[model samples]
Target: MTLSWSDPMFRSIVWQVVIIGGFAAIAWYLVSNTSTNLKARRIATGFEFLGRTAGIPIGEHMIDYEPSINTYGYALFVGVLNTLKVSVVGVVLATLLGTLIGILRLSRNWLISKLTASYVEVLRDIPLLLQLLFWYTVLQGLPAARQSFNPVPGVFLSNRGVKLPALNWEAPHLWALAAFVLGCVATHYVGKRADRIQDATGVRPRVWPVALGLLIAVPVAVWAALGAPWSIEWPVLRGFNFQGGLTVSPEYFALLLGLVIYTSAYVAEIVRSGILSVPHGQIEAGGALGLRQGVILRKIILPQALRVIIPPMTSQYLNLTKNSSLAVAIGYQDMVSIANTTLNQTGQAIEGIFMIGLLYLVISLSISLFMNWYNARVALVER
Candidate 1:
């Protein structure tokens, strides 16, 4: 049915069209102006510059990136990898530390609770940039190589960097890793079967112990069968410094430290609020049903609290990811820093900024999608 010109719905549609057209016109103006300005200044634009060689030096990179041999594309790829490395590790450590501090904040012990509270207040209140600079300073101010701080026999920290024992892998290590993967698949199947059994019999089977045994036993048996083809490559003190082990650069260490500490404070608050959002009557009900404290916490409390926790947790994760761009300040070769260098070298400012924003947008969207899927599974759905 067609609506009359005087109908309310027809008027509403006309207004919506007008608003959208206005927005489109504004967008067109901006783009046209930008193009004109670029042409006036004779500035190069477009993504083709990515293929050109990047003569800039990157101090720390996950992949092989020689300034003379690599293209801007390769350097950007290394930057992306470094960004992911720090973001992933920072998220995990922040969540664990945050959960611990959150739980401690609710502890009955006054001193423990106060200490955790103070930590949250101090860290979260301070600017994250300041914290990053402070941590970088601390790491860079350590003793020189000859007088390096040796926390343990093979582990050393100094102005040079942090060195720890590295893994020396061989053929048997592959076999052992394959066995471990198989064990994980088996364990998942076993857990599903156990859940089915519980639904039918009202008795929960001891699945975790069995799964743990399979994980350990299968890996060990495979390693033994293949003669345990792996060894620890320990760092050794050579002429002026230690060598032969894995070294974490000061920039990375500082970036990780700052992000984890700062983000964890906010995560702690989110966790605490999530736990408290559960009704007190539920805890009393669990106790009355003869469930132990651990069982109540694990089976009842965590499941409900997770629904509230995950959505906000996703936000913190995205924040941590974007904040990783701050690595440029301390000379860490993250994607943003590389993009900036690329911009300077090629004089392609617009293309460089677009690529940096696009990379971050992709990362944020990926995390958001995964968290949304998980949240759907765990959310409280009314029947």
Candidate 2:
């Protein structure tokens, strides 16, 4: 028996097949045209160019890289790492700062509310690129190495960069790190158990104190047992510069500053909206039940607010990751920057573009997937 056109299921299946077939046909046409164009121009295409030596110098790299020794593929990998580093750090810092500002925006104090509002308006209104340029210029205009700003004995700042004392780690540090990881896992279980107990009984267990003991006290105890396998290596003034410390270059600083500041503005708005989306009656209800302000916020407001907050927050995170491509403007060696160099050097525009797009697609999808999962967990379950 044939399915009737009037049937909703039959119509739905027909529409889906038509859409899929159309997409497939378009994809085939595009791919065929790209191949034909490459062939016509006698241009070589493949991933073999990745193995060739990249003779260009890069300012900053997390991994061991030398222009004379490493391949183009390695350079691309370094770029990916740099992008991830900035994106991760920017996301964390932005979220924290933005959340604070958002909370302050709703403050009972007039000064705080006005100040936060002004900050949000200023940051979001200014173009991110211009802000980056301004920061870079300001950093570059700082005093020279000889007249460097010394905020603390071991910390120095100048036109060159900011240098802080570096931690020298020993083998035992690994064991300390392992202990810290174990403590974190224990804390997570403890928190879950606390929540379960709270649900079963009317009394909520105080998990923060226990969590702090596990996460912080246990780590400290492990570190002491391991003979504190670390030393601070302070920056010392060499002939014209500071040496032997952790350095933050101006380019990286500018990029990070701009990303955090700009993204935080948007995040503040998202957070404010999320918090406001929660019904005021909920707060009054909590107060009626003899709950303290902090408890009400923690147990009620945040859980509900986070469900609204996470989806848009995910978009902001992805935007920050993608906007890291702006690192090229400030001479930061991010993925897009390195890929641009590769494309120019080898004249492999297609490959470079494809790689950059693929990397971004993977990153965006990963963030979306994670946020979606978290949102689902915290979301309201309706019967």
Candidate 3:
């Protein structure tokens, strides 16, 4: 067989090969160049340094960490965990706050709508880092533990951080958590079965009763079966600072507040746009069917609007996660901050950067995949 340049298929194949080969060649050259430069500078490459003692002090580690005993790998792993904590909490808080503001934007009251609109506009326009700095500064200015603000019992807010009653987590709590997760899975199947039955019989089976049992009763039963220990460790003021309970460090709180507030503004716009995309007829039809406004918004409008909202919401999530790297600025000791420290101490710049990039790529892809799956679920399907 012979291939001619005149053949379109042959031309397309040749161009694709050429483009791919060029990219491959460039990548190879860059790798070789980095290796050569590193060798010439007597700077070690690869990840051998990860086993070395970190000897770096970290504040507010989730797990037990000591600079003297922990390896660089363990430090980096902890850093990744810190990053995830901020990103996960930030995403949930942002979604709730954003959704509320988004709904208020549609309110009939002029003041409510305008106030929310102003909030969104102001937050969206400002740089996120500046907001973080502002929050951190404000929190730093709070009075000492002795003069801490007590807005509620068992809660203390001060320069040190926000301290609240801490629960004694035990093995029973873990069992209860597992049961709750199982219950959620069961509830999902029940809802799916209910939907199928509704479609087949023109009568929707009740889902809430089953959901209540699965989501609540089962978890409680499991907890009780294991002794259900309940105790709160209260923060007590001692030696100019509060001790005991769980303290939310100022750095962490400020970082969380900044990320949630900033990202929520963008998310609010996405939600508002999604809601507005729904046809007015959809609302009128729900009203015609004697459905209350809350029911209409939840059962009809929001479900349909999710089809529009999820894709953009995923972007906001990624942005919020990535933006958490700015925790370095506020001394939150997140992934990027710790990675930079490792890079400096170990001089494994390339490896440090590569790991950081890889972690974020994994996170972003995970969020995107989940959002895409949900988007498909809610997408209008032809019967």
**lDDT for every model?**
0.92, 0.92, 0.94
Q: Model 2 residue 284 lDDT? A: 100
lDDT of 1 by residue, 61-106 (tens): 8878899889999999999999999999999999999999999999
Q: Who is ahead in TM-score, 1 or 3?
A: 1
Error of 3 at 71 (Å): 1.0
With a 3 Å backbone cut-off (N, CA, C), the pairs that clash in candidate 2 are none
List runs of model 1 lying over 4 Å from the truth. Answer: 1-8, 237-241
Q: After superposition, how far is residue 3 of candidate 1 from its true place, in Å?
A: 4.9
lDDT of model 1 at position 113: 98
Best by TM-score: 1
**Weakest lDDT window of 10 consecutive positions for candidate 3:** 373-382
TM-score of each: 0.95, 0.92, 0.93
For candidate 1, the per-residue lDDT at 117 reads: 100
